[model samples]
Target: MRKHTGKSVSRRLVLKAAAVGGTALAMPAIVSRSVLASSGEINIMMWSDYLPDPFRDAFTKKTGIKINFTGIGSNDDILNKMKATNGQGFDLISPTLNRSLLWEPLGLIQPFDMKKIPIDKVNPAMAKMGETVWNFGGKGVAWVPHIWGTEGVSWRTDKFKPAGEFPSYGDIWDDANAGKTMGRGHSVMLGAGLALERKGEMAPGSMWAAYQSPEKMTEVWSKLTEYCIGKKKNLKLLWNDADTQKNGLLNEGVIVAQTWDGPPIALKTAGEPVMYRAPVEGAMAWVDGLALPVGVKNVDQVYAFIEACYDAALAGEAIKTHGYNSPVTGADKFAGDVYAKNFADAYPGDALAKLNPWPPEAPWYAEKRTEFVNKFMSA
Candidate 1:
């Protein structure tokens, strides 16, 4: 299994490793004696590079709260760790909206205490979306919107050319790109499955509805699995991490693959002829946010950390470093000209409006999705 801040591994392998307590799970870094002795330390489990170091330092300087960071490779890592500890290990976690649907119901995380943070500073639309997804069963607010991004197609313009306006998910099936394409081996597969259905290449099915009923799920996965089997020979890889996807495009000569917006933007910034496309079928937009785990020990520090994340300076720094959009309303004002311009260009006004957030899924959805992903991977 892959470590979040390190190498790449398949999602199926990682989940299995996590189940039996694999050593790949990141251990907490040693806290300085001064910070440990202080009453301001907050433990956080999140994607390794999601939060920039300068921002963490600035937050500590501003609030006197030290952040203990533990990075994980996938949402499954977050869920597995929380379950192993019975939600007692970390004070804060960053999970996507869909994964939180599973975590909240299991009592692994508690809802946000609105009064503790400056909720008004966040973008209203983004905040509302977070609330709808996190606040399950009217159980208090589960999380606050932090960073948002899209899952779409990233291709090497120097290697691949589309026959039409721009490439869509269908490019994965193009024979011209045989033995040079990749697909993510997780929930993003669900998004690509839906995209194929929308393009009329596959039979009609609701990717969203598959979450609610076993019958619908079986129907959807049957078509998706068959599609994968047909396309299997063309696929050179099935990636489970951003680094593998980026490296494949940059050095391994992969013509095209499903990817997050950040890597291609980074590659382009570094002079690679890579492009991230909001496909004609629509990009899958997602929000990852801060949430408290059950039995949290540092309430005051947790609130301080949450408040610090909303700071305009921190938000701007996040945008500059990771190519993610901040949910704070005015953070763009603090962003450097180049990054701001790049963000605007990547998500033009019309394109941004067309971005679709992943719909809420039932708890059973993740397990079923994983089962199909494992099947697709083995096929």
Candidate 2:
């Protein structure tokens, strides 16, 4: 009944983890003057509404430190700026789970002191994310798990018809659905790779590692090439953000499209004909965690900031406000029934009942993304 509405945020795709240069480095200088140049002020880079007034107000009230926050475009942007500063200015950075693998090794990150964090306050699920994304094999020990969510089919019910068996990634290739479906760019390509996995064709250590083999890679590539290049004409829309995916379905650009849970959940609450459906085969899931950049001067301040957010009460509020799943396990007890019902709609009933959290596995992505891009995108 209560729908979430806010301005659409820019989606940043990190093509590569390149060092910042003249213009890139200068951008943060401008932000510093406008945001964190005051005494006892800390600048934070994160997604919009991720840290609401409650948390900031609570933190400031509790710690006597001013919170100066800036909404960044993407994880890559966050990393680029932190790298440029050599981890000098910004106190905290929130980046996607997989991408953290890249940042951790660059000396951009360092481990946080567990003594500062009340381990009991954190949700077990989030702790797992922290271990996998930021602390992958003790690589970048500085980051902590924040809010997390996934990519899947967020559809407009009035415009599109989903039948008996819920659609899977393989459905994207169906000719009958041509020009009536949309897909997310970059990240959803990982979903496309998963589709390849469903067909028993994919390589080891690829995005489809859950369903791949070294022997089947060649056959998988041949098949994937046909779908992406040969069937490119059938795609009604290729979107990069949640707004575009929702708009495409509403505007008739596509009937069913891959999306995160937020947009469709918003539309449904507004009494619009829309739904968020995660495929039966499994959806491409992503998790994001908060990390302290290496070389932070105010390590105690950073720890205090993380500790405040780690409080289950604040984390629950963030999960509700953002419409993303909380990696914090017990936070669910604080959520409304509508949030649970709506969130559950995205998954198949059976699978939803026993959801298996997606693991943060980077070596799999690093090794395989190139071949997939070359075979699917190029073709």
Candidate 3:
């Protein structure tokens, strides 16, 4: 069994590399907790790997905060779980940075009490993302960075080669790779929109502009959905989480797929023939951050648990054992050198500049996009 490492590359290096890729990183959110953990109990709903068993156990022993944890797989899973309970069950919830905009309308989250958190230890850029993007009503913050990564292309090295100077999202739909590729449903649609935009089929910036309004989203997505439907034969299967991605490339005969950076990189580090990389159109970068559910019951305990999460050393140690990139400053020093190398290997020359940060979306647009995804999946 292989474990994913975290905070491996310094944020400065990553931000610089992204600069070289010809794009800027913004609107990202991902964070963790602190070492001055108060004693108590807290319920956590986050990605399964976010709290590796070792970290959870160590946190339990050190802080004496008996944690009741429920791990979720995707932002959709996070949304559904919160909605299913009306935000009453979990104390700490993790959702991707780009997805933060949807929570306010659902009335599911409360603004994070920054004074209760160790915000000073977090990565400056990630903290700014939360401060600006997660601020609801211009007064309170609703999310903080925990873990950040990207969604991009991966391939079976023995089976395929990029057609140009760099891999583009377009490669996923090319006839040659058809029947051998995969992607998450909604993101693949976004990738399609991007490819279409580049080909002059859709207006420039149409993909990001779809986030602004339902009318715009509908117009942009309509074309994207149709193009994706036409390319349906290209995918072997659409993966929803890390396991499916690994299995698709490792066992299900998939040669290429749009994937979170972690999965394929994990495989490659383990000596598999797979390779993951940023695409020419850009690697979709995002951060999964911690948020407070509105009805959080154990308020004090929640703060304690949150503070424990921000402890840079613990966060870095967790990364050494799981698949995540921390937003906690000083955590990278603990993730070992391999992660930095992996970062370099994946972004190879200007791939970082191509980072296509996932833009914020309206709750309505999110719902509408889900419908489009379902339509494409069923078509």
User: Higher-TM-score candidate among 1 and 3?
Assistant: 3
Candidate 3: residue 247 lDDT (0-100): 94
Q: Candidate 2 residues 1-379, lDDT tens each?
A: 3321111000011101110000010111112221232237577888654665666775675566787887764555686788788876777778876575566567777777776666566545446556555574665355666766666666666665665556666566557778887775445565666766666666533554432444444455445556577666667777655566667767765767777776677667556788877676565555567777666666566666665565555565655555675554455555456666666566545434222234443444444545665565555
Model 1, span 59-102: residue lDDT tens: 67655778899977578888889888999879899987656557
> What C-alpha root-mean-square deviation, in Å, does candidate 2 show against the real structure?
9.5
Q: Which of candidates 1 and 2 is the stronger one according to lDDT?
A: 1
For candidate 2, list the clashing residue pairs, or say none.
110-142, 111-141, 111-142, 152-259, 157-273, 180-255, 278-346
User: What's the candidate order when arranged by decreasing TM-score?
Assistant: 3, 1, 2
Model 3: residues with Cα > 4 Å off, grouped in runs: 1-10, 13-40
Model 2 steric clash total: 7
Q: Give me candidate 2's TM-score against the actual structure.
A: 0.73
RMSD of each: 9.8, 9.5, 6.4
lDDT of every model, 2 decimals? 0.68, 0.58, 0.76
Query: Model 1: residues >4 Å from true position, as ranges?
Result: 1-40, 130-132, 136-139, 203-205, 348-350
**Which scores greater on lDDT, model 2 or model 3?**
3
Estimate the TM-score of every prediction.
0.82, 0.73, 0.86
Worst 10 residues of 3 by lDDT: 19-28
Least accurate 10 contiguous residues by lDDT in model 1: 19-28
